[model samples]
Each structure stands twice: as structure tokens, then as C-alpha cells.
Target chain A: MAIREPIRTGGRSARVQQSIHRAVCELLATQPRESLTVPLIASHAGVTPSTIYRRWGDLPTLLADVSLERLRPDTAPADTGSLHGDLLAWAEQYVDELGSEPGRAMVRDFINSGAACQCSNLLRGQLQHITERALQRGEQAPAADLLVDQLAAPMVYRVVFSEQLPSTAQLKVWVARALAR
Target chain B: MAIREPIRTGGRSARVQQSIHRAVCELLATQPRESLTVPLIASHAGVTPSTIYRRWGDLPTLLADVSLERLRPDTAPADTGSLHGDLLAWAEQYVDELGSEPGRAMVRDFINSGAACQCSNLLRGQLQHITERALQRGEQAPAADLLVDQLAAPMVYRVVFSEQLPSTAQLKVWVARALAR
Candidate 1:
């Protein structure tokens, strides 16, 4: 008699999820987007195509899932001593991540998947964190929604619609505008 | 003898283009999005599918073209005797047009077709028209780009991502904020 891997256990499920997600990222890095398929991703991940289908439903949804994972901020917004400094630092990093070629692609995928609210929610939570930290330090900080309206909204608009990212100077101007508000 | 229609002449070509566009709008209103095809559109418009292919290249591009056509303002932004009143009226109408169900779909189609800048340029021209009218009256006006950054960006962002449109009251607040700047 052989010991069997328990079915649908957290440890095994987590590992498989990780492997699938990692396979998607690696293939996206190496392969053309148009060439990617469920079978190809499954083969790369050492799983069956049914696994991807049963879990993700389709290619766009899976791409959206992977993009959302990549977009999740790994650390808290830095405490830069003042609300202005904190907002500037956070905005710079936000642009650097979301304005890159791959980042833009992720945004498009997220939008196409019809789960754009999730992506916006991620940004909202991060901005809220920055504002709450500022309040704790006795600094006046703009509301997260206002920051989203003034700073992140414009940045995202440019990223989605324009060929160029907002310049550092432009980002600074937006930061100042939000702060002034 | 049957009169030979001028081949590829502006008059004939413009008529064909108009018919094709009209057919698309009709089909979109009545038929489900997924069921639409070039052959169907060509049949409805009484044109060959090759004509659509040769001109618009693909379905998404054709949809984007139609969406842009619909987005063009038919008249100038209303001048309400004050810049504040002008912007408020314009913003309310802007939200009403771009925040409706079909309007949101057009926005997504434009973004997906990657011709979003054309859409933005149309809006920028309208905002510039408002600002110019205000200046002609010797009233203080916010820069058009500033309005785009503060007002239009947030509106488009919400339209693209959120389930609910921004309320009329929110539009008033945004107008006040833009004018204050």
C-alpha cells in the first residue's frame, strides 16, 4: 500500500497555485502574448490543461488573476516623515510600477477581464494606508479618494491611453496638486 | 446605358461609409455584441465585407470608429455667463454622455482598440473651447490641461472601472475644484 497525497489540502493546493502562477509569469516573459494557451501554460507548469480550465475558466481570467497578483504591493508605503514626502515617494513608486511596459500590459489585461474595480481597489487600499500613516504622525494628508481622483486617476489615464508615461515633473505637479487640495 | 457610378470617388465613398456606420449602430442596439460580425454588417449595409476590411481593418477598429463618431459634440459647450456655470454644465453633460451604459461600453471599446488618445483629443478640444469662450468674456478660466487632469481623468477612470456612474453632485464638486485651481 502506498501513501496518497490528500485531495484538495491547503498545502498541496497552495503549491499548485503557486506553480501555475509562476508558470504564467515565466511564459509571459519569454513568449509572445498571442501565442500563449492553456495547454502551453499547463505543460510549462507540469499540470494538466483541465486544471487551468477548472480553476481559471479561461485565458483572460487567468491573465487577470496573474496580473492582479503581480500588482499587489509587497510592502507598506514608506513613512517619509511628512505627508508630502510620503505621498511623493509613494507616487513615484506607483508610477514606476504601473507605467512600465509590462505594468501597462497588466492593466489592459485587468480591464479586459472586466475586473477593473479590483485593480482600483488595490490602489485605493494603498493610498489609504499612506493617508492613515500621515494622520498618525499629526500631518495633514489628503483623503485617499481625493488622491485617487487627482493623482492616481491621471497617472492611470495616461498609462492606458497615451504612448508616454507621466514625466517625473508631471508626477510632482500632481502630488503638489493633491496636497494642496 | 446604366450610368457607371464613380469608383472610389469621395461622394460614393462617403455614402458607403455612412451606411456602414449606420448599420453598425443599428446592429449594436438590437443584436448582442458577440453575435456581430463583419459579414453581417456588410450584408446589412449592402456592402462587401472586403470594403469594411479594406477600410476599418477589423471589427474592434470599426467599433472604435463608430464610438468616436458618436462622441463628437454636436454643438459648443454651453456658455452660462460664468466660468463656473459653464464648467458645471459641461461636466454634467459630459458625465451624462460618457457615464451611461452604452457610453461606458463605447469607452471600453475605444480603450480596447488602443485609439483612446483620439477619444481624449476630442474631449480636450471641447474643454479648450469652453476655456477660450470664458477668456473671451474676460473671465478667469482654468487651463484646459488642468481641467483634463482634474476633471476628465477622474470621470473617465470611474466610467471605465466602476459599476456606478459618478453622481451629479459629484460632478458639481469636481467643477468647483477645477475652477478653484
Candidate 2:
């Protein structure tokens, strides 16, 4: 499934890829991930199944690609002058994005299919940035791993298992407790 | 898919149900949950799909039943004389069970399929039992919900996303930290 030529990012092929990405997200918003198939995505995207296969190879790979492309460059958490504010802002955004119904479907698919994704690593790096800033200011920052374990993990567990999205206030309280130690 | 008579706790029917439950777990041990179908389970269990549908209603219900039954009565944590001891014992056991490869697969299935489960709630109740013991002793026990969010959630998130099972020692440290304040 290799392309004979280098597919330029500004080419027609790139435009098709963009359309396919949009189609996948749209389908995921209303449908269960397991029920999605290549043919279904191709039909929705106005491309041939062969085009999907040639570009993405498989559903899991395509799903990962779509997830990566969905993260815009400016979407990383902004520094909010304090570790507490930074943690709260990041957690709110993280919960809002990943705890949304559509995001849940994407996660369910990625996890159930046992697909390898860089999203976790990406998220960890983003978190570390905030912790680093706090350390520079001589504020006792909780370890990035600890924050992930105590704060991020519970929110994710609830989303996947109970389908309950935590409110910002609920998340802020948990973050405060984590930082208290 | 109604049963004509009450499901007998005794007789050939009981034995058949047991066999079906065993078959589901065996299949889960070796295969992906989404790939598992009623007919496949029936063939593996030496029963018919209608038998499964009639008795269990669907795969999610059957999966939940198998999970519930597979949890032996003695699997719950015992009172280990102190909150720290009890929490460690339970977290280690919980991680060893759910963080194992087969257990992760089962969780992935139950989660991805949007199945309702008593496992999470059951786990919370068990944790509360230990906290309740602490309360009776006039020891300050963190809220059961807080304990779960800080301790259990992180362990589960790691297992599901990183596929790395935390060591008993690591779990103890986290549990200690969570209980510190």
C-alpha cells in the first residue's frame, strides 16, 4: 500500500486526507467505534476504500492518525502563572476533550483494538511542562507521574467505565488534593 | 428471550450455565472481546446461540456474568489490622488481577462495548469496608471515594494505557502518599 510518489502536504492527496479525517471524526461522534469499517469511512469521505488502504493501511492505524491530526499545534495547555491554575486549566481541557462522547468513542476504539498510540506520551510531555515551571518558581510541584496517577487516571477510569464526565469543580478539587501532598 | 420456567439453582441447567461461564472466560483469555460473537461462544461452549441468547440475553450481559462469577468469594480484601496494611493488600491483589494481560483484555472488552458492570462499584464497597474499620478504630481514614481516585484510578489507567502493571511496592508507596493527608 505504498504511494509511488511523495504526497505533498498541499497536494490534492493531502486535501483527500483532510476530508477523510473529518469524515472519521464525524462518524465517531454518532456511532460506536467497533461498528466502523473502512468501506463506511470511504463512503462518508467520498473516497474509495483503496485510497484509505493505500494511505492508512488499517483501521487502527487510521484511527491513530486521525487522533494525532486532531491535536492542533495550539491545543497544548497554556501556562496560568501558578501550578494550581495550570493544573486546573489543563485538567478541564483534557476532561472536556477526552470526556466528550465523541472522544470516548475514539478512546474505546483505540483501547479495545489494542492499537498503539502516542497520545499518552504526548499528554505526559504537556503535563511535565507545567510541573517544570512550578519547580523553577520554587513551588513544591507534585511529580508529573503522581499528578497523572492521582488526577488524570481517575478521570479517565470514570469516563471509560462509568461514562461519567467530571465537572471542572470536581477536577479542581482532586488536583488540589494531589498537590497538597 | 424469556425462560419458560425459573432458572433452577439445582439440576442439569445449573451445570450447563457453569460450562457456559467457563467457556466465556476461556475464550476471553485467548481472543479479543469485540471479535467474540454469540455463535462463536456457543460453538466453543458446546451449546447453541439461542441457548446463550435465551439465558444471557446478549454478550455484554454474559461477559458481565462471567466476570462476576469468576471473582471467587474469597477474592475480596481481608481486614489486615490497619488501614495501610489493608489498602496495600487490596491494591496489590487488585492490580495483580486486573493489570494482568488477560484481565486487561477483559476490561478492554467490557469498557469498549459500553457494558454496565458491578465490578467498579463492588470494588468501592470493599474499599469502604476497610475505611469503615478505620473509622470505628478512631483512625482518620481518607474518604473511600478519594482513596479510589488517587490509588485505584492511577493503577487502572496505567494498566489500560501503558500496559505496565505496577509492582506491589509501587502501589504501596502510592497508597501511602494518598493516605498521608
Candidate 3:
């Protein structure tokens, strides 16, 4: 007998969720987020509105779920052996993903929601993982919260205010400085 | 007999500008920014729409001008005896002003433009002034741009993302951390 994942409701549930996620992405690509509605998304996904409501409860929750689906990495970056390398790798991935239009929109939605959004928490978790690995290497690392403030805040600032993503070298300098002290 | 300021295009010009500026603030207090228009502001100010057009050219420009009018301090913070005092004072003032509703709206307008809005440049100039003052006191300060990244970026991140303005104590902690070698 095949072992089933604990969270899996079954194949049909998974398929419906996947279809809804795809429809949201397609609509987001062409339409302004403000114009997106449950009814519209349900029609495009070929599922009933009730299905969406039952699954996600509301639009913001659904969008947050979709954002996580698109953004969560398949697996955390392999341990790079040094804090600096791990941080640079993480920052580079962030710049690549959040620099895109869809990524940009997802972040804006998350930020505008005021209280910490699911995406911010997701990124925080990723930062925690990297910092834990750095500690495992016998390196004294800055606290994860401090790293997030220094690395993530500035980067997200550029994306939101200036619409310019920091270059890889810029990220490296910031990471190197933080790691050094 | 007396030397006069060249840019002070006196009397009627100043009066008209003041009226229009006052009207903008009054409307901004009661209405959503998106609903504001040149004609509405003109009528409220007792000026013609053509006059507003001739003066500021567009809504963004007018809003930016009004923001500066309200926000620009009469003088840069007088040189406090220490860099710590200077930075804390500056950050405190920043939190008080930008953390308010009007200031928040102005910043939102700047970010929504997705370009180098004047309000952003104005804030950068203010940051530059504070850093320059710190350097003048023979203190080793972080580069202004780096300071911008570390200091200004986090403050803005709190405002935009978390919607919680950093408390005065929080700003002081960040300033001290950045200023420390």
C-alpha cells in the first residue's frame, strides 16, 4: 500500500486546488488585482464559488495562499558552508523572484495588508533556516530577526519605493558587512 | 535700499498659491486622494482650473508640492552636540510626521507613482542633511547612501509593510546600531 501524505485530502481535492491556483495566476497576469473577484476566479477555474469559499474563506486569504504557492521554493537552498555564501544565495533568489512583475504584485499585496502577511512570514522562516545552517557550521551568526531587518527590509524598500531591485553585488556587500560584525 | 529675496514673487502670486495649497489640504482631510481633481480643488480654492494647471501641471505634482509645503521643516535640526542626539532627534521628528495620517497618504502617493516622485527625493535630501551634520562633528558616520539603506529603508519598511511606525525608542536603537562602528 502507498503511504499517503498526512495533509492530502485525496487526488480530487488536490486537483481542484491546483486548478484554482492556475486560474488566479492567469487572471493576475492580465487584470489589476483590485478587479479580481471570487465569482470571476471561480468561473475561470471551472469550479463553483462555494468551493473557493469553503477552501479559503475570503479573497485576501485565497490570494495569500496563491502567493505562497508560487513563491515557496521546492526545497531550501543546500547548505553553502558559510554564512556569507548562504546569505548571498538567499538574497539573489529574493532579487530574482521579487523583481518580477508577478512577484512584485504579490509582495505589494502582502505589504498593504498591514499586519504581517503570510509571505513575509514565509520569508522570515527561510531566513531562520539559513541562520540555523550558519550556526550548524560553528559560525556565530547575527540573530535571524536582525538579519531580516538589515537584509530584507532594505531590499524590499528598493522594490517598493524605487522599483529598482538591488544588484547581487549590493546584496553581497550588505551581507558581508552584517556577517563581518 | 534693501536687498530682497529674488524668488519671492510677492503679493498676488504668493496669496494665490497659499489659497490653492490650503484647499488641497482641506480636501485631502475629508476625501480619498483618488477622488480629488484639479477642478474640485480649483473651485474650493476660489481659483480657476487653468490657474492650477499653469502652476503645478498635474495632480501628482500638486500633491507633491503640498506635501513638501506641509513637511519641510523651517530649518534642518540644529547641530546637537552629539551624533546620537542629532540622529535620534531627526528620527523622532521623522516618525512623528511621517507616521501621521497625512504623511502616510503622501508617502503612499509617492510609492504608487512607481517613479522618483519629488516627495521621495525630498526625504532623501533630509537624510543627507542629517548625515552631513554627523560627519561635520568629526564622527565616523556610515556613507549617506548606506545610511539611507539601513536607516531610511527600515523606517519606511515599517511604515509601508507593517503599518506600524517605529516608536521613538525603536528609531533610536536603529540609529545607534547604524552609527556604531
**Highest lDDT model number:** 1
Encode model 2's per-residue lDDT on B54-146: one tens digit a residue.
Answer: 887777667766765565355557778888988998888888888776677667646644553355766778888889998998789998888
Native contacts present in each candidate (fraction)? 0.62, 0.63, 0.40
The list of candidate 3 runs beyond 4 A from truth reads: A1-20, A29-43, A46-65, A113-116, B1-21, B30-65, B115-117
Name the lDDT value of residue A172 in candidate 2: 82
- TM-score list, all predictions: 0.88, 0.80, 0.74
The best candidate in terms of TM-score: 1
Best by DockQ: 1
Two-chain DockQ for each candidate model: 0.55, 0.52, 0.30
Encode model 3's per-residue lDDT on B106-170: one tens digit a residue.
Answer: 76455433433345556678778877777887877677777677787888777766567788877
- Residue-wise C-alpha lDDT for candidate 2, range A54-89, written one tens digit per residue: 877778768866765575346557778889999998
For model 3, residues A29-122, the per-residue Cα lDDT tens digits are 8988879999999999999999988877777667767776667778986677888888888889888888887776676455333324455666
* Interface Cα RMSD in Å, per prediction: 1.4, 2.1, 2.7
Q: What is the lDDT of residue B169 in candidate 1?
A: 84
Order the candidates by DockQ, highest first — what do you get? 1, 2, 3
Per-residue error (Å), model 3, residue A108? 3.1
